[model samples]
Target: MIRAARILFKATLWFVVLSVLWVGLYALVPPPFTLTMAGDLFQGRSITKDWTPLADIDPDMPRAAIAGEDARFCLHHGFDWRAIAGAAARNAQGRRIRGGSTISQQTAKNAFLWQGGGYLRKALEAWFTTLIELIWGKRRIMEVYLNLAETGIGTYGVEAGSIRYFDHSAARLTPTEAGRIAAVLPLPKKRAAIDPRGFVRRHGNAIAARVGVVRRQGLDACLK
Candidate 1:
């Protein structure tokens, strides 16, 4: 028992040290590929990803994502307590499991962790979210999220999504196109960004409207 405990302690210490160094390095350099992308590749799924700088991406794309995912993104640090409380209350009432994850949390998960949900993944996500919030800030967080998020089956990033769905570069995405992409973000594997139908179409319209609202109210001022 003593030997096992000692080994566990050493492993835990090493893990913490490596995690810190990894986060620090990513704060300065863009990650080569995310864990999710790697997992997909290992599963023999084709990946279509094009790394594009935030400046090269259309301004509407980030705005639409912020509108759809976390309207209070700029106001929060790493988590949104109001959204979390609302989701928890709804879940307790037996409603569908809705996630209240902010862009920072999503970025942390996409960049560092594999895709899944559980206490362990959530805990690690929270840790990485806090680290990115402190080190990467809002702009960097949004940039990484936009670039790493899976926008469709095998499609990664706004650039690749734009090209795949609209036959255009991300920098040229129109408001409606941006909204469609953002709408599919919640369930990219099931939703279609291009030629969206039913719920996706309505959701995209809602996101587009909110994009205007965020812009007018300067809800995304932190990125600027």
Candidate 2:
């Protein structure tokens, strides 16, 4: 019994190590299918966290994103258990809004793992999420998210999305403008980043309200 337990522990350790290596390796090569979407790992570039620094962007941009996606970004170690629990409960009631994966998780999935929703995809994503959160921390994860979120069909990154939609850089995006951008992320084409319709406008306003709350409650409270 003791020998068997020791062997099982060793096997588990190897599996964990291999999984970490797999994610790290994938980060080196761009996604296999290679489409021209947000943060598609342009033809000639190496991976670097500094590729897009969080400080280079407008503060309101991240503020809106955290408000839209993961208000707990600053606080969580990678996973947002509350959001995950809420999503699961909603899914059980047949009212799932798709996903509750945090921004850090999305960065890991997009940068390393494959797309589509499934138990397997989600399991890998969760593991990779934790690994990257430990490896990259909050700021780098946010930087990657701003760069990789699919704002437009062919646009990638806040810089590209800003230019593609607004003909301006991300730094010029106002709070309302940033909210509009955040609104479209869940339904990229259906919601125009620059010219939101009534539905999109409603969503954008909701995100803006969250941002205001964050400002009042403080960034730390927003995470909570």
Candidate 3:
């Protein structure tokens, strides 16, 4: 028992050191690829992504993301307890599942962890989220998230999504265009950003409206 415990302690120490180094390295270098992208390849889908700097992506894109995903993005550290509480309450009531993950949390998951939910994954995600919040800060987190998030069936990044859906670069996304892309973000494989119907269309419109509000209220001030 003593030997096994010692071995476990050594293994955990090595994991902690390596994970910190990994997060620190990515602060300067864009991640090469993610597990989701590799999964697409394994399933015979071609990966499409363009790594645009946060400055090149239109302000509306991040604003739309903030509005549609996390309204208190600028205020949160790495997690939003209030949103998590709300989501948990709604989930307990048997509504459609809602995630309380902030952009920081989402970035950690997209960059380091795999898709889907499990206690183990969520615990690891929390660890990575803490590492990134300490090392990457808000702007870098948003930059990484926008570049790594899946925006379509095989598409990754807002830059690629912009070109795929709008035939234009993400550098000049209109509010509506940005909102549509943001709407597709949560369920990229299932939702179409262009000519979206039903919930997606309505949600995109709402997000578009909220983009201006996000800006006026300085909700995305960290990005600026």
TM-score of each: 0.95, 0.77, 0.99
What pairs collide in candidate 1?
A: none
lDDT tens string, model 3, 22-65? 99999999999999998999999999999999999999999999
Scored by CA lDDT, what does every candidate get?
A: 0.91, 0.73, 0.95
Best by TM-score: 3
Better of 1 and 3 by TM-score: 3
Model 2, 72-100: lDDT tens digits are 88888888889889888898899846677
What lDDT is reached at residue 83 by model 3? 98
Q: How many clashes in candidate 1?
A: 0
Off by over 4 Å in 1: 1-6
Candidate 1 on 70-175: residue-level lDDT in tens? 9999999999999999999999999999988999999999999988899999999999998889878999999889989999988999999999999989998888
Worst 10 residues of 2 by lDDT: 30-39
Candidate 3 achieves a global lDDT of 0.95
Superposition-based RMSD of candidate 3 using all C-alpha atoms, in angstroms: 0.7
